[model samples]
Target: MGWALAGRARSTDEQVLELLEPYAGNRHRICRLIRLAGARAARFGPRLAPQEHRFH
Candidate 1:
């Protein structure tokens, strides 16, 4: 799920937020996925842009 959430190239912010809505209930499963999803988002997110600064 998190992979899908992060990997859908054509997906919009609205779509991603909508997909995440069900997981916001704070159940253990949902919470764990939320964290994992966040990490995935960061990995695949705009921080990878060429003009962006990179930290060691």
Candidate 2:
């Protein structure tokens, strides 16, 4: 699931919604997962500088 989300990191929300439309019953839950994954990625994806690690 992580790898799949990572691969679609650049995809727009609309695109994701379209892709997930088939799973109508779980679409909301899936969207929530995507949001959580995005938040996690933003929190730990990369550092702007080598020294930035000390802040975390």
Candidate 3:
């Protein structure tokens, strides 16, 4: 799968997020989103709710 992604020029992060999108509104998503948002927030300043940054 890793090789396939490299061959296709696909981002692993995008693949992971795509898999997670179907479970949106679930706690799993909440946690993932929180983590992502936290990292971005650290750089940009100010925290945002997970919903503010959808997986699209």
Model 1 misplaced regions, further than 4 Å:
1-3, 25-56
Error of 1 at 16 (Å): 0.3
**The best candidate in terms of lDDT:** 2
| Tens-digit lDDT track of model 2 for 1-56 | 33354554467767766677777899778768867766543344555655554655
Candidate ranking (lDDT, best to worst): 2, 1, 3
Point out where model 2 deviates above 4 Å.
Answer: 1-6, 33-56
Clashing residue pairs found in predicted model 3: none
Each model's C-alpha lDDT? 0.59, 0.62, 0.49
Using alpha carbons, what is the TM-score of model 1?
0.33
Residue 49 alpha-carbon offset, candidate 3, angstroms: 52
Name the candidate, 1 or 3, with the larger TM-score value: 1
Candidates in order, TM-scores: namely: 0.33, 0.40, 0.28
Q: How close to the true structure is residue 1 of candidate 2, measured as C-alpha lDDT?
A: 31
Which has the higher lDDT value, candidate number 1 or candidate number 2? 2
In model 3, what lDDT does residue 35 have?
70
> How accurate locally is residue 51 in candidate 1, as Cα lDDT from 0 to 100?
68
- Which pairs clash in model 1? none
